[model samples]
Target: MSLDIKRPNSNKTKKKMGFIVKMQLHNNNNRGGSNKRNLFFVFFRSYYRWILWFFLSLYFFTSYFAGDQSSPSSTTTTRLLSNHNPSSSLPSRALIESSAIVTPGIFSGMKIYIYDLPARFNVDWVTKSDRCATHLFAAEVAIHRALLSDSSVRTLDPEEADFFFVPVYVSCNFSTSNGFPSLSHARSLLGSAVDFLSDQYPFWNRTQGSDHVFVASHDFGACFHAMEDMAIEEGIPEFMKKSIILQTFGVNYKHPCQEAEHVVIPPYIPPESVQRAMDRAPANGRRDIWAFFRGKMEVNPKNISGRFYSKGVRTAILKKYGGRRRFYLNRHRFAGYRSEIVRSVFCLCPLGWAPWSPRLVESAVLGCVPVVIADGIKLPFSETVRWPEISLTVAEKDVKNLRKILEHVAVTNLSVIQRNLREPAFKRALLYNVPMKEGDATWHILEALWRKLDRSYRRSRVLSE
Candidate 1:
């Protein structure tokens, strides 16, 4: 096909139309219009710029329409190409859009709706005492505070929630006598909260509190008692039997206190305190004290209601290794005990009133090899932390051979255990951080809850729907 554009400046415009009107211009040599044909050819040669401009315009026009037809495919190709080429000068629009989108984390759409209970249920006690948030039994407060600030797994919409969190600060009612948290009001407070939830929302009633989660960071968990016999007799609260509990109390053996579905969590120790200990720690990592223990190592462990404190384990340790060389055991409390742990090789983690103790977390976080004497005690975050690789476990009966065991481990794998203790992950896994850092105590609780999504009424309903 041919195109002819007229020129407005000269008489050549009239001659330009003559080429279109005349058909046999190629064979017009015998005709009298040969001059016209020659004139047309001359005019065409002089203004060749118009032909070039027309072809250029047509190429761009076709390209514009073709590009519109295949834009989606072109964008995908650009993104794929850009990903493989790290030195790409310009980022694709697809990459920019994807980067702006908030992707789901490991919880996989797991959403927990925390109850907006009254201040009496949680923060009222913290307002009264700063120790409420930092004490060993403060995991209840720690987990609640961490979950409140967490945006990843925490949701405000109750209708779409997978599980409900009841944030009751049960461990904050400090007794006036010994300054330890009193469990006298724990059961009643928790029971009242359950009653309040059942009255206010459909969630508690829908699953009979099965999909709800509570933190029972006490000696005997939901049983709300420090003594084993009483804790056993009382068992878990009748209302909280189906609910999940995140407690510091857990035993490997079958126990009434842990009868409820629960996740064993480490007792709360301030992350700042752990950081302070790390800051003041020795540069050479030299441990001066060999086989250190600083706590109530009793000469005669008192028998309270037929059960001896620590089951007579601490007393046995005191009787046998109290005056021995290199055995630094203290019967009195010291404010700077964490300093002693930082300078210790083997920190004793003998059973207190309960099997689990804050020393398990304290020793591990401070890079001390914990000589755990609590048999059948379940440590927190066991799935994430290899406890056996980092700490030693001694039976209550084997307290006599404790020195021999430590000596043998020192000769063999003490360095190996210390190296494992120095890992930041093990420390991070045991502490609760606000806003819920990954692999932290609060995060591990969410992981444990994720495993129990089978009991989530919302999840089951959504799957069926």
Candidate 2:
């Protein structure tokens, strides 16, 4: 019985034991691997969601800030014409082509009417008897030529013109006459003319209305004062009151109209004429016998001493250099070719009716050193130009010293001195050829007014919409 029991179930028991051990080991490995995989997936999913949200927020904030910074910081660029330098080099054809003294778009397509009455207004009298009138006429002519040459400008009859320019020469005092009694009378006439035209053409009132711009070239303050008085008497319209532009070439009286824009045009010979005069000039130390002061030899009523003082200086110069330099005092002519005399090494510019005279411009153009008797004459364009480098202005009390200075300049190298006078800025004035600083002033003022008017029109249109 013991032998039979020992061998009974060995094979069956061994096989069952092997199968249970293998199954338990396999289940344990599967559970451990599944736990590891689940833990890794949970950690990765959480961090990925956070990273995606962070990137989205960063992109949105950066885009919003960048857009906010770009909207308001904008500007415009404008090109300015280059200044001319006569001393450095000759002007190129392109520069010369681009060089226009007055730009065309300044008038905004408005036609300018210039009234010239040669019969009632004597051209000979202006050239010979009235120096002031002569200067005014010259300035007007220069402006006229500039405008006519410009393709953008159109000269129309006063009746058909968009802008009317009238130059009235008055001789009588304000106390005299009835219809043209005073400067005020002239202004009233002007105002009446505008009103009349407006009544005839309704568009004139609708377009320009009381804002009509007027430019008047008067002989002196009598006209200017008269206009102001008339404006007061007639009660200036709100629009036309401030639109008057007055220019007095040689007025002794101060202006009463505080609001009016006043301009003074000094006498100036054109650069081309000055050049011709220089070319005709004699070589160093040679003088023409007929060279004399043209125009009026008499002193200006306002400058009595200037007349006598200038004559005395001339006498002294004649006495000293008469024999050697051929001192010729023609009554009012400088050898018929005034530019030649101006082209000479020295030019004597005594005090005249105005502080700054055309002589300064003439001297600069001719490359001559002007010996100015600095007393009452105020220089034109002092704001933008340097006088010391351009001319020799000496005190009226220092004529003797001035003479010595001129003598020194004569002996010094003239070419270098002329070069100094021919700076770029100064040359532009010459090349563009302004008769007086007042011309430039008027141009700039008108230009500003036009721009303001244009802006207002644009704003009104925008608002209407």
Instruction: For each candidate in the order shown, give its overall lDDT on alpha carbons.
Output: 0.83, 0.45
Model 1 over residues 249-347: C-alpha lDDT tens digits? 988889899998999999888888888887888899788999888887668888776888998999999999988998999989987789889999999
Best by TM-score: 1
lDDT tens string, model 2, 341-421? Answer: 553556666643323445566666656666676464445434233455667766656654654666666576555656666
Which ten-residue region of model 2 has the weakest summed lDDT?
71-80
Q: Model 1, stretches more than 4 Å misplaced?
A: 1-104
Residue 191 displacement (Å), model 2: 6.9
Model 2 Cα shift for residue 254 (angstroms): 6.9
TM-score, structure 2 vs. true: 0.47
Each prediction's TM-score against the native?
Answer: 0.77, 0.47
Candidate 1 worst ten-residue window by lDDT: 77-86
